[model samples]
Target chain A: MEVFIYGLARGSTLALMAVGFSFAYGVSRLPNFAHGAFYILAGFATWVFAQSLGLNYVLSIAISLVLLAAIGAAMYRFILIRVRGMEVSEIIASYALGVAILEALRCKFVGTGFSTPVFIEGTIKVAGVPIDLQRVVIIAGGVVVIGLIWAFTHYTRLGLSLRGIAQDERAALMLGIDSDRAATIALAIGSALAALAAVIILPVGSITVNEGYDVLISALAVCIIGGLGSWTGTILAAFILGFAGTLTATYIGTMWESVVVVAAIILVLLLKPSGLFGRQKEFEERV
Target chain B: MDILEVKDLMVFYENAIAINNVSIKCETGKVTGIFGSNSAGKSTLMYAISGIMMDMKRKEEMKGGERITVVGEMRLNGEDIMDIKPNDRARKGVVLCPERRRIFPESSVLENLKIGGYLASRSQAQETLKYVFTLFPALKDMKGKEGGFLSGGEQQMLAIGRALMAQPKLLLLDEPLLGLSPAMETRLAQAIKKINEQIGITILVAEQYARPILPVIDYGYVLENGGKVLEGTAQELIDNPDVKEAYFGV
Candidate 1:
């Protein structure tokens, strides 16, 4: 019961971290390597607002989220826009920006001593396992986020256009959907999501620069194993990795967690090169 | 009155000319056709008119790949619109139903139509959706089906329906008949005529097969090796020996 409960919470956390990355990639085919940097930045930004400025916790989170979203949009408009179609350049450019921001934060005092306050205080017993209220919030928040995204993509015009652009960019363009505008909006939303996840999940642990790299790796692992750009696949891969990590920690050793995540990615790549749900282009019907 | 007029339009991919000194005019509320074989600049002409060539040019430049050059005067309703972006042009009522029916594969039929109606008002979208379902009743039954799973005829219908959802004044259909059976081609040709007659939307259709399309077009142009070789009314084209030999397969 304890293992299952903890694994579910971890899986939800992974989902939250990866959803934004997957969404941005799906729309623009742009892999935002800065996603982890943005996540950590949100945590620190909130801490500064709430701790230093002495603002309300909720207000600090809202302001930081908006700030992160604007930063993301600016990142795409100013930097990523020039290198949009070149895959190698996109990766290099985004990763460089991410490293620059994270390293700058390191210089400023975002370390192990900094942490955000949790939304709620206390613990609850569920299925004979004691789980923190924050963990429950994370799990519920993940589901709500996923549901909202699903509805947005299905019912809203802007969301529909994003899906259209993701499927066939030129086709969407022909219909008058501006590709650059959609991509910019995608980046903004993606960044805001990363921030939301950070604010919700950071309360459980202290902030550190090292966590930036770890979050990126875990998000990448989930995205790769589930197939990049697939929302359903991301959630499924998260649970798979989450349970595997929990089992390894319980049975083998806690140090094997990272090893298991990496191994899962390697094994998935070896078995299915296009991830699990990726619609292989070569197999697509060409008439 | 001419809805669209292109004069001395020249398009080049690096040094190779894809369309050279081509001039064409589409009259308001009429179906104009351009017939050409593969690599004959039919798609290029459509892209140039729809302003998508500019987008391709930008993408190519960004990748440091081929340099695309487009030079010409394109007038829509007597106003020069060569500098407008594709989406802006779409807002100005020019929409392209692209080649191979580039419908969103993962989205359902209804969702694809809704996406195409991005620039439309809420009421316009709703009314257009109803019109599309009425025009292609077959789509109404398959509203939930994924676009990738549709048949060639159905996909082509959906493509036209999707373009109609954009509420274009001048619709550019790039090879709408590609990969369809003879019966489907004839049916689509008739539907194109009905759209023009009923909705009064000006249409420019590009195709390699001229047999089914020739009967529906008011005026047609023949392109060969990236240059216009002939232009005449549909009757004149059918009577011309060269057209009957090359295009009619007579």
Candidate 2:
């Protein structure tokens, strides 16, 4: 029960962290290295709004989400747009911006003191396993986010336009979707997702500059394992990694947990190069 | 009046000319066909008119390789659109059903149509979806199939149907019958005629083979080596011995 319940919590946390990065990359083919920056920045911004300004907690989160989305759109329009197709440059540019933001935050706040209040303050027993209410919320939030994303992509015009661009830019453009516009919208939504993940997950452990990097790594790991663009593959990967981590800690020492992740990635790469559900066509094209 | 007019158009990839000093006029509510063999610049002309040349130019600049230069005056509905983005051109009612049927491969047939309707209002989209279904009923049956899974003829139908969902004033078809059976070509040719007649949407189609389309086109141009060599009414082209020998295999 402990392994199952705790693993579920861990998996949800990962899903929240990674979905935004996967979404932006999948849609625009833009790997947002600043995704982690947005996550940490949201935590800090929400903290400033909620604690320093004495604003309502929910309102603070809402404001931060909007701000992060705008920042994301601006990032694409002003900076990343220029380096759109050049993959290597995109990574370097975004990663540099991410470092700048995170390092700036570290310089200013330098905190072990930054954290947010949980929305609900309690504990619940799931299958005879005691879990905090925030962890439970993260799990529920993960399910809800995935559901909303599925519906959005499947049913909505704007969402479908983004997916269309992801599949074929020329075809999408021929259909009257502004490829850049679709990319901008994708970046905005991705940033907001990062912010959402941060607000919900950061309360458990204090937000720090390093957590930003850690979040990005976790997101990257999950996305890679899940097969970069496969929606089902991401969730399944999250659970797989989640259970893998839990089992590692339970059987071997907690020290082996990190090794398991890297090893699994290497193993998957060696075996299925495109990740489990990854479309192999992209690889074939490159070859 | 001409819905689209290209004057003194020239395109270059560093030095080799793709299109040279080609001028063409497409009348409102008429099908104008441009026929050419491979690399004779039929696709390039379509790309130039649709503003995809500008798109490729930008992409090349970003890549810092293979500079593409397009110097041309393209007037759509009497407004100069020589340097506008492809999507903006699409919004302004010149939508291209690109060569090789570049439909979204991973997307379902229905989703492909829906994406094409991105610019349409909800009611317009609904009406156009019905129209597209009626025009290509084969598409209606395989609404849930991925576009890549469709046969070549079915894929061409989906591509045309998808473009129709955009509700363009001037539709551009670039080699719409590139890889299809003769029967399929004739069927698609009839459908193209119906689209022009029933909806009154102006069409500018580029083709390699003129037979399947000759019956449907009002005016046609023959292109060779990226330059316009001859053009006239379909009957006049049929009467010309050179065109008959070269194109009709007489």
Among these predictions, the greatest lDDT belongs to 1
Residue A43, candidate 2: Cα error in Å is 0.7
DockQ of candidate 2 is: 0.60
- Isolated chain A TM-score, each model: 0.98, 0.97
Tens-digit per-residue lDDT, A66-147, candidate 1: 9999998999999999999998999899889989989999998744899998889999999888999999999999999999
TM-score of each: 0.98, 0.97
**Candidate 2 per-residue lDDT over residues B172-200, each given as its tens digit:** 99999887899999999999999999999
Each model's lDDT comes to 0.92, 0.91
In candidate 1, position A134 carries an lDDT of: 96
Compute the lDDT of residue B213 as modeled in candidate 1: 92
Q: Any idea what lDDT model 2 has?
A: 0.91
Worst 10 residues of 2 chain A by lDDT: A278-287
Which candidate has the top score in TM-score? 1
* True-structure lDDT of candidate 1: 0.92
iRMSD values, candidates in order: 1.3, 3.9
